[model samples]
Target chain A: MKKLINDADDYVDEMLDGMVAAHPDAVRRLPETKVLVRSDAPVEGTVGVVSGGGSGHEPTHAGYLGEGMLDGAAAGEVFTSPTGDELAEMVRACDGGEGVLCVVKNYEGDVMNFDTAAEMAEIQGDVAVEQVVVNDDVAVEDSTYTSGRRGVCGTILVHKCAGAKAAEGADLDEVKRVAEKTIENVATMGTALTSCVTPAKGEPTFDLGEDELELGIGIHGEPGVERTGMLSADEVADRLTAAVLDDLEPSGEVATVVNGMGGTPLSELYIVQRRLSELLDEEGLDVAEAMVGDYMTSLDMRGCSITVLDLDDELRELLGRPAHTPALTV
Target chain B: MKKLINDADDYVDEMLDGMVAAHPDAVRRLPETKVLVRSDAPVEGTVGVVSGGGSGHEPTHAGYLGEGMLDGAAAGEVFTSPTGDELAEMVRACDGGEGVLCVVKNYEGDVMNFDTAAEMAEIQGDVAVEQVVVNDDVAVEDSTYTSGRRGVCGTILVHKCAGAKAAEGADLDEVKRVAEKTIENVATMGTALTSCVTPAKGEPTFDLGEDELELGIGIHGEPGVERTGMLSADEVADRLTAAVLDDLEPSGEVATVVNGMGGTPLSELYIVQRRLSELLDEEGLDVAEAMVGDYMTSLDMRGCSITVLDLDDELRELLGRPAHTPALTV
Candidate 1:
């Protein structure tokens, strides 16, 4: 394909350089590091939030690096985790008077790398570091008894809640508490209508017939929980939301987010949510806040996911706070 | 290919129905009309902002219905325009004590339908209505003695700037003025690496080889002005920006938006903007603001677009104002 890249291998670095150059008002590159931070980062006493994962999920980590989202983000190759050193540099660059909070997604490589980086940050900067592993996707089972579930679209909620808490002048521990609370309250379930093509691979991650879908595929195109026949909008919504509600049912009023997995139309997402509402209404659940769009996405998979968070007063207020980021806002 | 849609024809209507059911806090359906409006719309004396287009570009007009973006939106079939009656109902539902402004993309059906609705609103109610046609894409050209230019990604800027002005209590004429000013100052050019498949069509709009790109493609999978060999990032940026600069070069400062047409990764978009920065620097131009993301997408087409808007003081301030829409923020 005709791509605007110098070399496929150097695409991430070249793009990062341009990001710093073009959005000087928003982001700046950390000196001698692959990390991009808010232009006025390292705020004095507030807990610093850092997040990173694959590179292709644009505006996820990097685009969220602004006033009320992430402090710094270390980007890796497409669908690959950053090395320990890269993650360490990002933590060191974001550390201020308070400690740093690493919002690591529950991916094997990402978990291992961020854990190593947290140790490195303690050794290098004498900064207190804590990590919140987001495991929102209800599709995956415990890979191993030692490892937990995989994180998916629910990471965006973690970013928002943590950002709001940090913006409220919360300390590192408080920020971590809010993040963990949000994570516990949130649950997500995703399905893919079509496989996405990885640029390097030059083909879809897997083959899917025109009449089939991959239910609960991973962001990296990992096998879904199951492949099922096509469904009505209501059925799809029921399947996805049933999985989510089984994990954490919203009590009283709750916050809801319907995420599009890259290639699905917004219209379809609404249909999914429509079914979701009917299902929720049947269970007598009330929606306090709702957002539906593309927040976290697989490259070009055509599907949608649902996330519901049972909100208390604090999380509700935090969720309602104003946030200025590239991809999200309150 | 395995979509959760009931039928091809009912897809858009079902999705709209679902949107209203799910986001009761954010959207409401005009009973009998099926248009979507903010739940708290028609604020007294505030100009109403209404926009809509085809279905595939999720969150373009629909997701943007919020505090400072659009008051209402009329969704059509996938890659098709909503009928005139639908547009008229949207206008009525959003009309407040003052007036209503329709931000119509420069497509034949959209412009015609919205214009018809404006006429209907004038005769039916005390509401004042005006229309602003956005023709910002430089990809399409106006033939001699003819006015036919396609609106592309830059329409988001129009919605944002105009929505801000309307939120400030601008009347119909003033809102029209601000929208027109943005349209005149903005210019855009797009190129596609791969064609997207319309759900109903079940096939790509067009085909491209492994190394080919279609430059200047329309938002609705229309043929581009030219098809050329693949180019490097610098070359792609040069070619795209050259058209934009040729159309309207900002004097001192400009607001630049590098938008992906759905499937292009941010990694590639950054490289495109890197070259754009070098070219703008060579021209001694300053960028007042810049943004990059998938704004107005064509299904899952893999490509990016460049938009440059010459900014004056008033336009710059409006652009800088907070816009709390689903797709964008302050």
Candidate 2:
């Protein structure tokens, strides 16, 4: 209820307007739509990559729109899915000569909407479109908004790898292949110390005891696998990393992400990262890369997630490629 | 008390360890000190830029250390200034033949400690050093930790400008001049919806009722100019922007920053930016640059700050120069 916002109804639109204003040279809004695209989108012969979901998890789909990441992103209201029509608009806007690829999370709403958009693009505009669904959250098999496993922070890795491949002049099929591969290798688990409040609701989506935390929490404030007493930073990191490692059983080199759930401080994320690095070393896994920040988040939720990607040589090389986006640059 | 930390004593060290581990290619720690230096420090014939303060402000002094920003940073305990000895060590590590420039925020402890460090380096190591104190916060004339005025988010602008100038091979005096110019032109004001808790204290630094907010709150939870009922995001933005404009009276092109305290969501920051952009337009000021993020922060305070800098051609061009750091890149 103490959020910094004008009106609940205008939250998403105002955020999008602000994003365009802040990074005019890098991104812009599609006319009369809630879709944001790279400033110089629809490159003549390059594969155009796109992604989107709800609005609260910022720097995810929209902030990733730039030269080396997403070509366009259709934003929905907070914790809601974008309309299929808006998504179809994004597909058309991003479809260059090389075709378009949609990188979507594994939520039921997102998958259905993106699928419908792809069909619309193909039937209405003669645009070639492919889809890759990310279901990397190993915490739950079914959730409030998802049918299978939920997609969490690991989606950012998919965006990074697939975007890099597309920027390398790969075709839509190649980009889709890389994105799927990333989904196959990545795993994530999260815990929430506090619940998130949607702008429209103006109250916490869930109630958590002051001394308790929800493990395996979803980004949209869905119930997690366990509700337990609060633990130390090291204990939380261990629980999350162990869940991911047990799920993926990654070998050789891996990429680790300690993503904050909106309201956590960067200092705390680093603390989590330190323990994660130690755990990885103990498991005899070499870290290929490490990212610690609020890459994807629930709106003002005080929590953190750990994501691990088993990186092959190709994925590692692709992740290292230069990317220029509003929230991420490499 | 629901923070992701192991022990209060190890908070700063663990965070620093994690930072270095996550960004090994860009930053490293000095032996036996809480000082982080660029991977390639003391670039010969380049004026070294050094800054530091309490440990809670992640990506401030430490995150800014890189190719074109800070050469080194000395970190203190949570909400405490770094010791003169450690800061002296930082000066020694960063000093090249062209001398070093110390960019100190205008907190009493930080200013005094940095001044002592500069003197120590000049006397013991025979290194030339210059210091620029930033007191751009227009909230009050004096505060709990400062005398003249507090330095808030505007200090980041000083780092960007002076760092770019030094990277251009400017000498100590030149870098000092540019940093001083930035300090003179920039102004900032902040408000907090909730209080920040230091790791050691494990309690809120200050308290606020559910319906109230503190206007012009200091970064370290110092008392602000006024405490009032919570306002809408647009109203908050209008008040903050009006205060900054009144103090700065900036004309022509201006650079603005909407900085979030540690716990605010990016969506809210963008909302604030949207209103600020409109206010700037109404004032007939051209926005030369806009940054919206958690640039400088209190530990986990849910609030935001607004900073505006009147940019001349020199500062504007320097702001555009290429710089690579952990938290910021341009």
| DockQ of all candidate complexes | 0.57, 0.84
Error of 2 at B182 (Å): 0.8
lDDT per residue, candidate 2, A138-239, as tens digits? 999888888899988999999999999999899888999999999999999999999998988888888999899999999998868999998999999999
Range of the 10 consecutive residues with the lowest summed lDDT in candidate 2 chain B: B54-63
Q: What is the TM-score of each candidate against the true structure?
A: 0.93, 0.99
Give the residue spans of candidate 1 off by over 4 A: A1-4, A144-146, B2-4, B142-147
DockQ of 1: 0.57
Instruction: Report the CAPRI category for model 2.
Output: high
Question: What is the per-residue lDDT of model 2 for residues B1-330, given as tens digits with 9 covering 90 to 100?
Answer: 899999989999999999998888889999999999998998888999999998787767798998778999889998899999999999999987899999999999999999999999999999998999999899999888888998889999999999999998988999999999999999999999999999888889888999999999989988688999989999999999999999999999999999999999999999999999999999999998999999999999999999999999999998889899989988
* Highest-lDDT candidate: 2
Candidate 1, residues A1-330, lDDT tens digits: the string is 345677778777887888886788778987766689988888777889999987766657787887778999988888888889989988887877798999998988899999999999899879899999999888877642116778887888898889889987899889999999999999988888877766677678888887777777767777687887776767777888888898886778788888777666666677777778778878898887777777777766677788888889988888888877656655
lDDT of 1 by residue, B114-160 (tens): 88888888888656888888888887676221178788888888988
